[model samples]
Target: MSAAEFSYKLRVYIEDTDAGGIVYYVNYLKFMERARTEFMRELGYGKDAIFNHGLMFVVRDMAVRYLRPAQLDDLLEATVRLIDLGGASMTLAQEVRRGAEVLATATVTVACVERAGVRPQRLPRDMTDSLRAARDTNGN
Candidate 1:
C-alpha cells in the first residue's frame, strides 16, 4: 500500500451537484480518474502513448466510502497512489479531500486490456517500472 501520491484539484460546479448543492456521489469517481490520469502523465504515460500502445484500461473493481459532502463552488482535491501492480492490473488508492478533510476514499483496480477486443493485456514495462520507482514501500 506504500506508494508516492499525486493530487489534482478542481472546483465543484453546479452541474456536479444535486438540487441541494451537494456533490453527487458518482462525481467523486470522476475526480479520482482525473487524478490517476495526471499521475500517469507525470510518469510519462500520457493518453496518446497509452492508446497508441493498443491498450486501454478499464476499472475491474472499486470500493468507495463517502464521509462528507462537497457543495457547489467548493474546492476539492483528488489524490491517488499506486498500491498494487499485477501482471495485467493495478490497484489505486484514491481520496477526495476538501482542504484537510477527506470527503471520500476509494480502492480501485484497473485492468489493462487490448483496445479492440477487451482481452487482458500485459502492463507496459515502462509504466510498471515507474510505478515501482514511485513505490514508497521500504524506500523502494
Candidate 2:
C-alpha cells in the first residue's frame, strides 16, 4: 500500500466515554482501528473476508499521543494512511478528530500472519494490487 489517507466518520456514544463524559484514552486506538478496518473494506476486504483467507492481520506495534479530550455525542472522524507496506507488515498513521480538533494520533504497525499458527506471512498479491490502485487514485 502507498500513502493514501482514508477517513471514517463516527459519533461518540455513552459507551465510548468515561463517567466524566470524556472519551477514554484507549478508545482512540479503537477508533483508529475502525478506520483501518474500513480502509481495508474499501479495498474489498471486509472483516470476514480478511480473516477467512487463513491469514489475518495483527497489530505488531503502536505509538500514540493524546492531544485533546473528546466529549460524548461528539461527531468524530478517524483517518488511516498507509506509511509503508512491506512483504509481511505495514505501517499506518492514524488520527482521531472531532471536527477540526485532533484528539489523538498514532503510528501502528501490523503484520500479516497465518491465523492458525500466528506466523508471519506475505501479503496476498491481489490485496496488494488493490491497495496500490487506491493509493494511485488518491494521488500517490
Candidate 3:
C-alpha cells in the first residue's frame, strides 16, 4: 500500500477516555479495528457479507506502540495499510494520527477462518482481488 490510503477519521469522546482524561490505551485498538472494517466495506465486502460467506476474520496477533496520549475531544485519524496477504491470513499496518503526528502504531495479523470451528480457510478469490486492487492503487 502507498502508506497514505485507507484512512478514516473519528472524534475521541469522553467515553473513550480513562479516569485521567487521556484516551484509554485499548480504545486505540477499537479505532484501528473500525478503520479496517470500513476499509473492507469500501471494497464491497462488509462484515455481514463476509460472515454470510461462512468466513470470518479473526485477529491472530497484534503489536502496538504508543507514542503519545490522546485526550477526549481530540480529532484522530486512523490509517490502515495492507502489508502482507497470505492464503488464509493478512497483515496490516495501522496508525492513529493527530494531524501529522502519529499517536500510535500497530501491526495486526488476521486470519480467515470458518465461523463454526475457527478452522483456517482460504480467502475468497473476489475478496483477495479487491484487496490487491486497493493495495496496488494505493501504492501508486
TM-score of each: 0.93, 0.93, 0.95
Model 1, C-alpha of 6: deviation from truth (Å): 0.6
List per-prediction Cα lDDT, in the order shown. Answer: 0.90, 0.89, 0.92
The alpha-carbon deviation from the true structure for residue 88 of candidate 3, after best TM-score superposition, in angstroms, is 0.5
lDDT of 3 by residue, 1-140 (tens): 35436989999999999999999999999999999999999999897899899999999999999999999999999998998989999999999999999999999999999999999999999999988888878342
- Top candidate on lDDT is 3
Q: Which stretches of candidate 2 lie over 4 Å from their true place?
A: none
TM-score of 1: 0.93
Rank order (by lDDT, best first)? 3, 1, 2
Candidate 1 — worst ten consecutive residues by lDDT sum?
131-140
Model 3 spans with C-alpha error above 4 angstroms: 1-4
| Candidate 3: pairs in clash | none
Q: Which candidate gets the maximum TM-score versus the true structure? A: 3
Clashing pairs in 2: none
lDDT of 1 by residue, 1-140 (tens): 45677889999999999999999999998999999888888778888989999998999999999999999999999998888899999998999999999999999999999999999999988878887887764431
